[model samples]
Target: MSQIDVATKSPIRQRTQGLRSRIEAFVRTFEWTWTSAVLFSMALLFFLLISAVVMPSFWMYYAEQKIGWAGPTDLQAFLEKPFGTSITNPLSLEGYKQVRDAIAMGLTTG
Candidate 1:
């Protein structure tokens, strides 16, 4: 080939070589920093989000199974059940007084 032909091809060859070098560098950097804990935490968070989003559906299904009924239902009965109270936060003195007043009002009115 002529010198001009060689010169014309040189820039394309250099660009392809540069691109390959950059890709290899990126792969090396990623491989060096990748960790199992990071991957595990990402997967765990994904499942947690999925579970949180699906929990209401599961709760409704269970309520239907227990009652032999289907379709939308009141959540209050599920909230007021004995196991419901187990999830309650322990009250501070001020919080206890507030809850007491609320309960007292609820009881007196209905």
Candidate 2:
């Protein structure tokens, strides 16, 4: 008999093996049809539309509200400090203040 024993496997390996088996069993139940492909594509398209377009629009709206601007210049200001600028430019209300504070305090070990 082989020296390797199933029960001797590490907990993580055992758990992963169990999860892989479960995933395989679940996937085997699915019928891969053209309809499924179209459905998946539509779902992916919807997700992309929402994340790429709708979400940024919402963020811009919220940032405009925070910055208290409602003019043509609002677009310029938002473009200057988009949602992913930095820690301080989070909403671009004041700008740089929060970044200064975060820098003053060292990052947590955890």
Clashing pairs in 1: none
- In Å, residue 109's CA in model 2 sits off its true spot by 34
lDDT of 2 by residue, 42-107 (tens): 999998777666665664555456745333334455566756457754555333333333332322
Candidate 1 Cα deviation (angstroms), residue 98: 22
Per residue, candidate 1 scores C-alpha lDDT tens digits across 4-64 of: 8778786778579879999999878764335866887899988776565555455445545
Candidate 2 residue runs with Cα over 4 Å from true position = 1-8, 25-31, 67-110
Report per-prediction Cα RMSD to one decimal.
19.5, 10.5
Clashes per candidate, residues 3 or more apart or on different chains: 0, 0
**Span of ten consecutive residues with least summed lDDT in model 1:** 78-87
